[model samples]
Target: MNKISFMLNGEKVSLYVEPNDLLLDVLRDKLGDKSPKYGCGRGDCGTCTVLLNGKSVRSCLILAIEVDGQEIMTLEGLSKNGLTDLQKYFIKHSSFQCGFCAPGMIVTLDEFLKKNPKPDEEEVKEAISGNLCRCTGYVPIIRAVMDYVKNRGG
Candidate 1:
């Protein structure tokens, strides 16, 4: 096992991980955060998305040991005191149906909006292109993101 240290949900965390263990496994099996689902398990599906240093990444594509000293943010970290504005907007717009891809979509959208606060429709779609949702057909998701941006005066 390799000892890895990283920041999770704004708190410093350290744990032992097997060399072959994926970040998704460590986060869910070890850290007890199940939001990053084990979908596809091959990185094609973005259901396991997380933020590494404020950038969206597929946790299933990364080894637990590779994240040493990095700052990781899961869906749980996005809400400070309660539901974030984005989260509220998503719910208000019914962006999620089955909710399988909500966590990754939210994290990806959060990172995207941070960089491009006023993203065009295409830009918004491109930002979440990595994530695949079988529900809502993506229109509602895009609308929710646009609404959030508008509400924030971006």
Candidate 2:
């Protein structure tokens, strides 16, 4: 095992991880942060997406050691100050159904909104295009994103 340190949800964390351990596994199994779920291990499902250095990335595709010096943000991090505006909008619009993809979707959306604070519907859709959601049917998700952008906050 190798010791690695990084900023996780604004907190500095150090842990021992195997070189071959995937970030998703480290977060979920080792750290007990269950926000980033295990879906398609190949990284195609996007259910394991998380913010790495303020950008969205597939945790499954990243080795735990790769985040040694980076900032990692999972969905749970978004609730530190209570529910954020984006999260409220998600709830207001019922953006999630089965909820399995909610964490990744929220993490991805958090990064996307930061990059494009005022994004159009198409842009919002494009931003979360990397994530896949099966239950809500894209309509509600799109509406929530667009509405959140329109409100600018709340």
| lDDT of the candidates, in the order given | 0.92, 0.88
* Candidate 1: tens digits of C-alpha lDDT, residues 54-132: 9999999999999999999999998757888999999999999899999999999889888898998899999988999
True-structure RMSD, every candidate? 0.9, 1.4
Which pairs of residues collide in candidate 2?
none
Q: Output the worst ten-in-a-row residue range by lDDT, candidate 1.
A: 76-85
Best by TM-score: 1
Lowest summed-lDDT stretch of 10 residues in model 2? 145-154
* Model 1 alpha-carbon miss at residue 131, Å: 0.5
Error of 1 at 120 (Å): 1.3
- Provide the global lDDT of candidate 2 against the true structure: 0.88
TM-score of each: 0.97, 0.95
